[model samples]
Target: MFLRAKVRKKDGKEHRYFSVVENRRIGPKQQKRMAQRTVLYLGEINDGQEAAWRKSLEVFDESCQRYSTLSLFPEDREIPAEASSSIQVKLSEMELRRPRMFGNCWLGCELWRQLGLQAFWEEKLSSQVQRETVPWEKVLRLLVVNRLIEPGSEFRLHRQWFDPTAMAELLETDFAVAEKDRLYRCLDRILEHKQALFVHLRQRWQDLFAAPFDVLLYDLTSTYIEGEGEQIPQARYGYSRDQRFDCKQVVIALVITPEGFPLAYEVMDGNTSDKTT
Candidate 1:
């Protein structure tokens, strides 16, 4: 890969933007053509930053059959580097900043997109006003991704996980998406779409993996909640799987394919019998 510069004129001034790019051949063998694909965007580097980047950048010397440090700028430019393309760095002075977890977060987002959930949620959770600061779709995506990667409470995600993961970069969103209030509010809004979401997921699973629907496994489980659960009518003293008979609990019924793909789930009153539900 190499650094490529793109020049744009705004207000009669020429501005340059830089990106790391690589060339690839595409199309069938007979109709193959070379194309440049951008790997990363480095917006508007000044002379000093350019010099620093050049000092650390490395390139492969095809003729010499070895890797060598080279300046990104042209030879005529006033940049600091050895004339022969060799440079030295004081490693001790360098410091890593804002290092965030990326791979799992990226995978989660990619899987979300692959399942067509991005468009699905965008349509279902669209903002009513033009100036809506909250990107509901992205907020929901963040919650789903967080749950998939490291299941945690919205509070933990807001206070800890969001900042440590690369969700912001992946979603093109900021910390606002992880705001505890917004996360909770988003949950309140999605219940209406539960059935639709299940339908969409089922269709996607079938389309992508050809998941079978002929045979389904159904099961029931109970989880107890602490406190009085005053606002939750479904929370009641019942058969607790955890043996927390003192605390209120709710029953969850799930139907899944033999291959372990969830088809549907329902949360019922703790006292609801599995036979009745």
Candidate 2:
């Protein structure tokens, strides 16, 4: 049994009451939590024992835990000039799971925040009624970050990559329930803002790096797709960077600063000549 105090201020005066509590389990059978079970309610303290009781109870409550943390200093050990002064260590009994690259997501999210991409999307993609738990902007950001870091398909992200990622928590949504079609729709929706995005990114790039645009380093590349799909209008027989000239491909034109920060890009038909694009 230990003392538990409750203090309330009423009309510029403090009223204090104490309780004798016992430890008990509260939550569900599978997820139990420690709670104080009140054994007796003691009236407001009018004596000196109140402070003493409070201090003792505080120590008792703190020590009633499952884990033990210890710090040790050896009396015979001498402090070496090159060695560290103190060594702090931690130990955990719980099994660690769901490991993901937190730093990668953090960097991606920070970049997005600095560029004001989230706010810009929210403003542009505003709707009359948003019933879904996750917003379109958030979904887009998740896909963008995933592409930048992991580089995978929507199916791969939804089925495999997303659950282990910090993206769900960072995007403020349940990613497991996020359908792949919604991601595709997000891609379609954001295409309308392509020009706007380029303009926004250009301003942010200049502001951040103060990079001069007097001269730009332009480049061209082509990615080959193995499947010959009837629906893909851009896919045609072209010179493939992957040495798969037999497969259909699409061409990409990129403009970057001397520092290699991309300022603009263009997607051309696979048959489009390098000089023509």
Best by TM-score: 1
How far out, in Å, is residue 4 in model 2? 38
Model 2 gets an lDDT of: 0.75
Clashing pairs in 2: none
The numbered model that scores best in lDDT is 1
Score residue 170 of candidate 2 by CA lDDT.
Answer: 78
lDDT of 1 by residue, 1-277 (tens): 5677899999999999988766779999899999987756899999887666654556667899987755333344354455576444443355789999999999999999999999998898776324557678888899999899999899999999999899888988788888889888888878899999899989988999999899999999998888999999999888888989999999999999999988899999998887897
Number of clashes recorded per candidate:
0, 0
| Candidate 2: segments with Cα more than 4 A from true spot | 1-93, 128-132
Error of 2 at 110 (Å): 1.1
lDDT of 2 by residue, 1-277 (tens): 4676899999999998887676778989999999877755877886587765554334212456642221122234454366465443232233567687778998998888888887889987877117655678888788888889989898898888887777777776685335788777777777778888888878888898897889999889988887885687888887778888889988989998899888888888998887876
Which residue pairs clash in candidate 1?
none
**Candidate 2 displacement at residue 147 in angstroms:** 1.7
